[model samples]
Target: MRHYYIYLLKPEIASNYFGKEWLIYQLFVEGETAKKDLRTIAQKQINYISGTIPTLQIKKNLDKALRIRNDFYVLKEHYYIDIKALESKAVLKDHGNMLTISASGSYQAETVFFEVLRQINPAFFAMDFENRNYGWLNPVKQVNYI
Candidate 1:
């Protein structure tokens, strides 16, 4: 249930939901990983709050800490996933609670899906897990997803 704040990547001038016109904020992102200092990752990057870079470490760093190792879910054995198709319908939210999980055997598919959502051009389109869900914001009267 531990959480860390992570931001999404978007071009400059785009609006973020963290109440700031700029796109940098430490919102709740769930993960099992922890570090002695959070500043190291920030140091490696030019600036999470100032650059146009997509704040990639949100996933990259999480992936590193998760240590997927030899458990890549096999996808389709021979046929690979059509990433473009999956990404076509998803929309990345400005702020979200990202959760990283480790599974094995039959649960591998679930892990892949989580990682996939974190990737793609826009992160996530729409999803609901437990009570924590996505695609709902105060400014918008209704929740919409592509």
Candidate 2:
């Protein structure tokens, strides 16, 4: 299931990634949420599935060292859509570029996701998952048997 997030961004940043015409609107919606990070999640899943990270060939330990230049959980609308679809008169109907672009809280959401892809290490993500899921590490509570 895809989760949608609506966020507001500065007009300046919005114009940078989108365009001047898209500046009027401040609300942006997108489905780009991952636990810890997409890279980490992907890495862990890949390792668990393959029992190794050689196929992924990503740095399993140097993830944090590789800083996230853009954002960790940012959103972008144009990722799944193409320019042709945006410019199609029939597709857009009577609307102008108004529906074409909405300002995300950050301009480099896609960039960040891509960067994470490059920096993710499977060994790091695929660790001790039996006791913990995405949200938090749930330590086994001792009952202190009498």
Candidate that scores best on lDDT = 1
Write the residue-wise lDDT of candidate 1 on 49-113 in tens digits: 33332335544543453445332212221111123323311112223333223222342344344
Inter-residue clash pairs, candidate 2: none
The model with the greatest TM-score is 1
Q: Please give, for residues 107-143, the per-residue lDDT of candidate 2 as tens digits.
A: 2332232233334321111111222212101111233
**Candidate 2 Cα errors over 4 Å, as ranges:** 1-65, 68-104, 118-146
Residue 3's C-alpha lDDT in candidate 1? 18
Each candidate structure's TM-score, on Cα atoms with residue i matched to residue i, is 0.21, 0.16
TM-score, prediction 2 = 0.16
